[model samples]
Target: MDFYQTDPTLENYWRGVILFGRNVASYKFALAHALYEVDKSGSDLVTLEDLAVPFSRHLCQHLLHAPKQITSRGSQYLETCVQFNNGEITQDKLIETTVRLGFSNVIDAFHNVNAGEIEKRFFLDERKTAKGIRLTDNFFQLSERPQYQNLVYETNARWNLVEQAWAMGVSRNLVTVEFDEQEQLLFSHINARRVNITSCRDSLNGYQKGRCFYCFRTISLIPGDSELADVDHFIPWMARNEVNNINGVWNLVLACQCCNRGEAGKFAHLPSRKLLQRLHARNEYFVQSKLPLHETIVNQTGNQTTQRKDFLEKNWQAAKNNRLFHTWEPKAEGEATF
Candidate 1:
């Protein structure tokens, strides 16, 4: 069975990640797109060498841009490949990293390789016709899944929006400005991250199947409902300086207005262990979504699951240490049974 179809919470978790998360190199999204395209003929088999051509082209066009003239170093790994565009790195290195990084990222994000410390025998799996691995049955099914398609669309759309916003801001900058104009432009785009909450809610509500992220209560998206939806910073926006990109999709969750503004809601408090588990499970669903969010989270936190959990735990401790404590009290009637 497609778990996303059966599990509303899992599905919503993915939507939250794809729509709201900050992406770096977009390896996860690129890999999925390539697989979906090559498998469009309905074959479960795919060639890594063949995939590299299209995947490389897509990343180069969309992601492998020059380092920011001032602020960002571009994506950490991809920037190494940017030297290829500037005639600095060898084509062989470019091709090698393209295939290796893409393959590793897909496996890392989806296979939970680090969880088991597997030997990566799967990457070397090959067939007579092509030097490539077969798609996992789970992934093969996901290639044809509509939810997966939505994930790709949302991930690319968000990247395009941020890129365009940055480009627009840069294009309008004046040479006379004394401040790092490009940095200013980048921050301007970053600031727009806050606006994504409302813009993404319509689709997020559908992905969440109209349930609040915290309380799991049925939330109203219908016109003129008294109990409207609210976009909550799951980690609380008040911790912005302490947490990186607090407004990004990873930290944002849909909540009922009550849970958002209630005395106990997000008032600089870390959630209970149960809620933290829900958040972790939700993030795991994002990995299964086979989109950039998976790689994004892995990159943001550590590569290992324990590391990611520890990272969240540290953030929670930081909140408590700073005295930002507000206990989340799920209402008896407000919580969903699931």
Candidate 2:
């Protein structure tokens, strides 16, 4: 099935970009936020200065992956701003670099629109000359359409989630992977700390009805049972050494020790399609609960239900493509109690 059937807004937004944008990194989301801000101010006009804060804020929120991780010197420009001084690169220097790069991406987007990249008339009503610019009627209708309310809701919802997560010092970080030049095989793992996932279990346990995420068996709370719980990284934690924060509730799930560590357990493997489906349903419960975790998931995956499913599917595919999709063996030995 096409993605639009499951998540119309997200699908449409992506479609808009594929049609109108230059494919610059994260430009779609950045552009979405920019449209939201201008619309909120009851204006269709936006200047370079008007976009600076939003663009900077969006770039600063996530640990971006360029050719390398954010900490790497040659990584994305915004990531550089988040780092401190180290000789030629300082926070101030990075900030200036980001501003220039961000403006360039925006200009490129406009150029794409003007060059008839979009099938519709224009992305902006007023042509962008040397000064500022105004958005087109088509742009507003696309952004503000009633059927697409989730687009705006999801955008703001994610921003709020990120703000809260950052305040609490929780990060949705990525691990970097390196490949050998000749063999084109992954290099050895780099040392990285495990993300603190214990912080989320109590609520997940409650939400899952105390069931293990993979096998659908109840997880025991008691001290000595084999059914005792473990917080598992749905996507194996070891696959990507550079991603340190795979412990977010979006990726963490309650699991029985057997499914977690038994001989047949899935270690660093991508789960079966069934488990992916189950995880998507499970995350929906969190979204329905409207808890802080809900915001986190929406922020990570787009607000639509399908987007979350798509995120897992894509990650699983990536792992498989990299020869990282180890097989998981799920064996059920009737539910045990403490």
Candidate 3:
């Protein structure tokens, strides 16, 4: 079953935009951050100049950390953002550049996911008529939800993951993303120094659509919450010596507490063949998203689809053959989400 369709709430639709929307550049995320900033003012209609302030501010802020925000090499607008961050340009000049060049695509593409427009509209683009966007009722309603702050955090987390991937050149370097069990974050080694990318829960939860990897139950990303998701290794981490890059994105998934460590939880047991197929599908979603994780997974797994499938099958067989590992299946499996 399609997880996003299960609920189809305004929040889910918003998640769809942030989680599943294409990311050629980080513009959508910047626009999303700007939307939230503007929404706080209780303003339904916002001018382009008003929106550009926060939009450019967010891009400049992120540029300081992850310099490479886009996959492509050149961006005039981003250059202006960099100048603004470097104190080379005034804030007014940065805003003017953003107002002219920034919204060229993100405004139209923000609602798009998986090659199509989402069912709900967060904002109505009025660039031609009013030179700005008018926040829709759906957008306002979503902002009022209790999960609003969490959604903002998720958006920033996703942005960091994508930008870090691009900045690190994961596709070329084949950076192995390792999980810090104690910190519950994903990190990679650069120049022999470890760099944390993002919270494992926030990075992977979006791909899972906030559902448990095995049971398909709704999961939370908030810390210290009883329902917070766990960062699970699809092929038990104990088998790291046997399988290459055990901490790779392909091997990581988010699971509910019950499914990760509770009674009858997966633990170190090898997932069932059915769940293995689901794992394959979930990894493929990562590849298809064309995010930074895409090339990392492709490099670690395989370049071709059949080759990747075979890679997983080989790992599954190897794990299954090990006397130390036993096959496992969730007691109460929900619908197939991947």
Name the top TM-score candidate.
Answer: 3
Candidate 2 residue-wise lDDT at 94: 52
Residue 169 accuracy (lDDT) in model 1 = 45
Cα deviation of 84 in candidate 2 (Å)? 47
Candidate 1: worst-modelled 10 consecutive residues by lDDT: 174-183
For model 3, how does the per-residue alpha-carbon lDDT over 69-159 read when each residue is reduced to its tens digit? 8878799999999888778989889888889999999998888888788888988999999999998889888889756767777898889
- Candidate 3's displacement at residue 50, Å, is 3.1
Any idea what lDDT model 1 has?
0.52
> How does model 2 score by TM-score?
0.40
Please provide TM-scores, in order, for all candidate models, with all chains considered together.
0.43, 0.40, 0.85
Give residue 238's lDDT in candidate 2 (0 to 100). Answer: 68
lDDT of 2 by residue, 157-274 (tens): 3333333333333333322222222331212122353222122334355445446777757565444555567777787776555333455566777788778887778777778877
Cα deviation at 185, candidate 1, in Å, is 16
In model 3, the runs with Cα more than 4 Å from the true position are 1-13, 40-43, 71-73, 88-93, 113-116, 144-149, 170-176, 189-193
Per-candidate clash tally: 2, 5, 0
- Each prediction's whole-model lDDT (CA): 0.52, 0.51, 0.82
Model 1, span 1-338: residue lDDT tens: 12233453433444443343333335544654565567455555567767776666666666444233112445544665566777888867777776666555453443232233222222334544565767645444444543454455444544543444344343333101111112211122233342221234443454454578877776655446666677666777677667765555455566887677887565556667677666665565544433334444565555677887887777766765675577565664344422
